[model samples]
Target: MEEDSMDYTVFLEAKQLRKQAEDDAKLLSNRLALLRMEEQKALKKIEETRRKAQEIMEARIRNQELLKEKEEKERLKQEEERLKLLEIQNTKAQDRMQREQRVEGCKAKNRYEAKELKEKMQENLEIAERKKQEELEIKTNMKNQIKTQKSLAQEKRRLMNEAKKAQAREELERRIREQEQIRRNYEDSVSRMEQEELELIQRLQNTQLMQQSVYEDLEEAMRS
Candidate 1:
């Protein structure tokens, strides 16, 4: 009975130790599996973060390109506006030059008109003086004619009052002498008056011709 009991006790102790070792090995295997699962989860999270970061960087690059394009368009528009304004300024300068030239032309025309008017006034004054001189000459000629006629009549009356009819031939000769003297004086006076009147008439014709010529010249000049 003692040997059998000792053998059985040893066997029971060995079985209990083997069972404990097997339980410890199973616990180690479970911990290793849990660590592997946690490592996989961490790697998945890191990949997701990297993908989101790449997306953000790409979006920023596209926004930068759009902003650059918009800035370029705005710069071009501003340059166009500046060029348009420069053209307008040049046009205004040209207009001002034309206006100045027109004003200068008007001033020259006014000066010419003033000179022409002054010349016409001088011509009119000369014509008035010539007319007054002609009137004075006519009055002088009429007075001379009246005096000659009065002297002839008084000589004839004196001859009749003497009653010297002895020689009819002498009386007739004396009468003829008186008549010839009066006729010669009257003819000389008429010749002088006729010459002066012809000269006056010629002057008037020349003045009329000059005026007509001036008017024709003015018409041709205006047409030109």
Candidate 2:
């Protein structure tokens, strides 16, 4: 009976050791499963972060493209405005030049008319002087031919009649006065025309200066 009790004690010790080892193995397996689950969750979080970063980068690139496009549109609009302004300035300058040319032409025409008038007046004066000289020569020849009293008396009577009839000197003086009046009138007209032309040129210059000032203001505004 002693030997049998010893054997039974040994058997009981062995069985308890086996049961403890099995419980330890079960705990280790559970810990390993939990660690795997945590690793998977971390991997998923990393993938989500990476995807968000990629989306943000793409959005930034798209925004940059949009900004570039907007800038290009603004530049084109400014260029168009500049071209329009240039065209306006060129047109105004052309109009001013044409007006100046017309003013010069008018001045030339006035000068030509005045010259023609002067020449006509001088020609008339010369003709009147020539006729008076011819009449004086004839009168002197007739006076030399008187040789008798009767002839002299007849010549005197003729001379008296001619003196009463001939108003050449008066007519000549009247024509001279008329020529002087015409010259004065022409000079007055020329003065008036010149004054009017000067006023017109001044007005044109003032308008040009105003337009230039306006253009400069527009340029300043655009720059600002």
Which model scores highest in lDDT? 1
**Which tens-of-lDDT digit does each residue in 1-224 have in candidate 1?**
57556545655555555555555555655555565555555555555555555566677789999989999999999999999999998999999999999999999999999999999999999999999999999999889989998998899888876756645545545555555554555555455555655665565556556555555654554454
lDDT string, candidate 2, 1-88, tens digits: 5755654565555555545554555555455556555555555555555555566667778998998999999999999999999999
TM-score of each: 0.21, 0.22
Clashing pairs in 1: none
Residue 57, model 1: lDDT of 67
Error of 2 at 178 (Å): 99
